[model samples]
Target chain A: MILKRVFLNRLSGTWMLITLVIILSLPLVIGIALYLKASPIFESQSLYQLIVSTDWSPCNGNFGFWPFIFSSLYVTVLSFLFAAPICLFAAIYLTQFSSKRLIQLMHPVIDILAGIPSVIYGMWGIIIIVPFVSDVLAPLINIKSSGYSILAGGIVLAVMCIPYMLNMLIETFNTVPIGLKEASLSLGATSWESVKHVVIKKSYPGIISSFGLGIAKAFGETLAVMMVVGNMVQLSFNPFEAGYPLPALIANNYGEMLSIPMYDSALMFAAFILLVVVLVINLVFRYFIHKTQSQ
Target chain B: MNKQKEIEELFFKFLSGFATYSLIAILGFIIIIIFVKGFGALSLDMIIKTPKGGYYYGGEGGVLNAIVGSLYIAFGATFIAILIGIPAALYINVHLVRYKRIQNTIRYFLDALWGIPSIVYGAFGFTLMLFLGMNASLLAGIITVAFLITPIIIRTFDEVLSTIPKGLHEASLALGSTRTEMAFKVMFKQGFSGFITAVLLAFGRGIGDAASILFTAGYTDLIPTHLDEPAATLPLAIFFQLSSPIPEVRERAYAAAAILTIIILIISLTARGFSKKYSKSNLK
Candidate 1:
């Protein structure tokens, strides 16, 4: 009986290891498959041309990704600009200043905020943000266009990513030793002084990674941004101008991709780029988290 | 100099307070908007009947198909996720506990996977479907969602398992139990509540997701009777309804969002309740 049990453990353990290996290899395998499938059809065009050219005309075989790439960075950067200060302040408030009761109350709220669906965010963006941008904000700024613009996308993306950024920043702030903060206070530093001097300095690495995580989320976000980004394939920096990001382009167009020549290849390349960039950002973010954790 | 320092301190303090309250205000406003905008448009028929015509131009019928479809896809995906997630988590905690390097590497990959956006997973699934000569169906959506939520489940549950004292494991081993036995019989008790929380969190995530299912789960008015049949979901339903040029259809989108929010609220509340209950009866 004991021998049988021991053998079962070995068998199951081997199976578990095999499963682990397969799960780890899935991304690489999919990436290679996507690359192979993409490379053949785009063989006529240089990869450089495809990446650098601003044109996205599938009929003309101009599969340049410059517009989409720039648009993604533009909107993601705009979101960071809008979201970073509030999230940092909120984290500082919760970690350094809030009472225990307030902390207990606020933690669940943050978690619930994190749990809300991205698509509901799209609904909110459509109902509230779109018209506010087009009718009110844009007119105030003397810009004229549809409600769905890069600015709208950036605003909605900021809201969508705030909870995640707050969670990370708060966790980072909580990691600061109580002794350090108390010592700063004992040396004639006010509460804000300690936060500004010791807390912020100690947690800068985590805060940066939190920002990276937020940027990655906005960069890769599709549905909500798709609802608001207006999906105009263009290379523009004007916040009011309509634009398309890579994920939004794929989301909106992939259904009809079979009919368009070289469309699939172009789209595949975009996905690959997004996947790789997101993976790299997350790896760096994890490095920060791991470093802090080990300390 | 003293006045300037005091003013600076007050300014920073006010800024932090304003930021926190702004978050609270935003949450309040979103909830109010959904309920108020959705109240008049929310009809019992929408919950009980499928759209009679197409889901365009403010058409008739309810989101019965979508509600049913959403539940099916989420539950199906959760079932698959839990099966693989729990065992994989068990493997890491029990089998690989001695090999810190291998465990960290595995965790590193999972975190990376978690960070990969749902849309990328959708694109990857779409590509894989094309390669397999299979069309979009409920099965495809479920599989995609399962892949999407696995990392979440494993990571959350892994944290739970990690909370168990090291002495408990040592004690179990000293009592002539194998690692597998110890995992299932000893550590599992302490982690079961957390396991529930992990699955619920993944379920909430799976149901609310629209991107991963956009292409894979082809829309249908009927509740899916087979795995191959296309199915409607609440998020996609809201997306399509809100896209309509008609004002009435747009209002229905708010109603759908309200429903989605309520379900998630219930899940989170129930999770808190579960934690309270389990902690009271905790072994440690």
Candidate 2:
């Protein structure tokens, strides 16, 4: 019985070790694979040459990534523009002025928005949003009717990102002590003035970090942007133009690259870049969280 | 003074009202669009029929295979993640590995793992499967998802385990329990529901993910009878059908979207309910 107990004890320890290795090693292995694949593309061909070339046709020898990079950045910026102000004010309102009943109603709605699958987001975008944009939004902008454009994709991504930002910022804002707000109010500051000057200012770091996380989510978004971004390679600022961001580019072509190793390698290179971008943003948020707690 | 106070109160009320209404409107609009399109495309065959090449129309097909495939992959991945992630959480928090820097680096890598785009994981999985000469197997897809979701489990598990009062562990040790016994019987015993909640969160995330499986799972019309074959998932079905020129395929896509949304909603609600129950019971 003693021997059996010892064996069982050892087995449990080994099981934990095995699980640790599996969880930690998989991404590490992938990170290494990405570096190995990416070095040649960047080293043999200069980084500037690879990125700045406007043409992205993989069928020929051209491997420019400027368009894709710009599109990703553009969409992220536009989405943040739409979501940030509304979410920030909403966070302020939720934390300060809202009643219990209103807070109760708003919380689940945000949770549901956050919980809905990205593909469903995509489905909604393609069916209702794309048409609305093509008919109403496109005509207003005086562009030809292409339902799948950056504007449509950015608007969808903006809505998707708002819940995340609002949730994080609401928590941040709530953590601002009520005592500070009351003291400021008693000292002749209006509620709006107290909120604008003190509460929002105090939570600015958390708010920025939360918005950074939102941008990260937008930057890494795949399905919604993929379906509605129109998948064009042009480098125009026009929101009506179709575009290909990194995730969209990777998703659209990875399946059909049956035989071309170079094409596969280039896509792998893009994936490596995307992984780095995501990792950096996540680390920043972690740092910000650690910093806030330490403070 | 009374008039000024009344005016200020009215202004605050107006501001709050408008802000809350807009936030609610955003969510309301999303749900409306999702269901309107989702319901418009729903059909009976969509739940049962499989996919075919060329026009996904004029044939009896359902998402039976996709639904099953998503569950299989989600379950398989969560099983692997829990098996690995929970212990790692304990080890990091309790074991205090001899090499703190190495352990810290691993923890950071896991954090980064959460942020790594699903497509990158898919590509990584594709490469790993190629190395093993297992082309697009269900096992490969599960591995990809398991890697994708491991950080979530670890974070939640660590938070839950950390919140257990140190007194409990000390009491367990005072009672002559060994360190392992204290961890398993004392610390982990209290955190079981939280652990399950963490696993369920990972399960929901794994199932909702479409990008990681796009390349690793590939596409197969046949329902996966075994883990060796390629399988279609609900997300992939929605992706392909939305792009299809056929009206019939589009309708099926909406049904699949609705089903996927409903599944996610149920998982989320379950997790929320479990946490609420735990909080309530502990208060008494």
Candidate 3:
């Protein structure tokens, strides 16, 4: 009986081992397949020509990614510029200065906000934000059209990114030792002084990490941008009018493809580039988090 | 000295009070805006009926289809992810007898996968699905979301398995139980709650995802009768409706967003509740 039981155990163990092997090997297999498929197509296309091409007329053979790339960076940078200061202040207010009860209340609220779908954010941008931008902020920003310009998209993106930034900053600030802040306060420093001299200094790495994550999150976003970005597929420095990002371009056009290898290859390269960019940003953030935690 | 100290204490208390209230005000404004903008659009028909083509409002268009698609895709993603992720996690945890270096390398890849942006996953899945010629299929969306959910479940299961005390496994083995039975019956039983939480976490993430599904889950108005067809999901529905120029569609968008928000809220809160309950029950 014991021998039979042992045999059954071994059988199950073997089954599980094989399952594990398959699971662990899937990504590697998928990666190899992707690289093999991408390499042959990319070998013929000059990277410089592809990057500089202004025309995205896939139907007519133009597949320039420069406009889309520039638009992505432009809107992402603008949104980060708008979001960083407000989020920094909010994080400081929550962590260094807010009372425990307030922190408890605010944290869940922000969590819920963070949980809200990006799709809703797009709706909010159109119904509440676009008009405000078009009628009000557009004139101030000196853009003629407030309806679908960079300014509108940037503001909406900033709002979408704020919760992410706030969450990261709050977590980072909480990691700062309370005793350090108390020590600064005990030394006749004001609350703000303590935050500046002790808390901020200690949490700077995390704060920077949050900034990088915020930028990456904004840059990689698709649906929210798709709704507000107007899918113009053109390159423009102005905030208003239509523009496209790589992810948005793929999201809007993936369904329209006629199974062309060039189109597929373009998308693969774009995905790879976006993946690399996001990984680089996240690695920077991870390094900061590690460095700060070690200290 | 006492008076000066008291004055300083009073000043600090006031400052803390002021700062705390302001933080509350900031978070409060965000919730208030969502509720104010979204609440009025809620209706019974909106919750139950399907949108009648192009006419987004007042035509008894219901969120029933989207609700089902969200659940279907999320569950599909969770199923595939668990099937793959749990074994990998278990192997990494228990069965890594040789090539520890290779195992660790794979483990690091999973960690990196966890941090990869959802949009990139969307793009990758979009391109891959297109290449596979399964354009706009729910299965493609499911696979995409599965890719997104993999690292999360693996991490959760791996951590849960590692945290289970070794004594349980040892005792099972002493009783003549095989390594597989000991791992599955004893360790898995101990880790069941955490495992459930991991699944719930994956489900919650799958449901919350928008970018990853946008391309693969190609938006369709009609109800999905099969897995091969393009189906509308709550996120995609919300996106299209909100972006619609029609006021009725906009209203439906609000209702949809509100519904989605509520569902996600429930899932997230439930997942958190399960973790707490399981941990507490285990302690008792």
* Top-TM-score structure, candidate number: 1
lDDT of 3 by residue, A199-249 (tens): 889888888889998998888887777777777877777677778887787
User: What overall lDDT, based on C-alpha atoms, would model 1 receive against the true structure?
Assistant: 0.85
Candidate 2 residue runs with Cα over 4 Å from true position? A1-18, A21-27, B1-17, B40-43, B49-55, B97-110
CAPRI verdict on model 1? medium
Candidate 3, residues B224-251, lDDT tens digits: the string is 8888988778888787676666887777
Every candidate's CA RMSD: 1.6, 2.9, 4.5
In the range A68-149, model 2's lDDT, one tens digit per residue, is 9999999999899988977887887888887888887786677778777788888788877899889998888687868888
Better of 1 and 2 by lDDT: 1
Lowest summed-lDDT stretch of 10 residues in model 2 chain B? B49-58
Per-residue error for A216 in candidate 2, Å, reads 1.1
In order, the Cα lDDT scores of the candidates are 0.85, 0.80, 0.75
Using Cα atoms with residue i matched to residue i, what is each candidate's TM-score against the true structure?
A: 0.97, 0.92, 0.83
Q: Which prediction has more favorable TM-score, 1 or 3?
A: 1
Better of 1 and 3 by lDDT: 1
Residues B37-82, model 1: lDDT tens digits: 8777888987888888855667788888899999999999999888
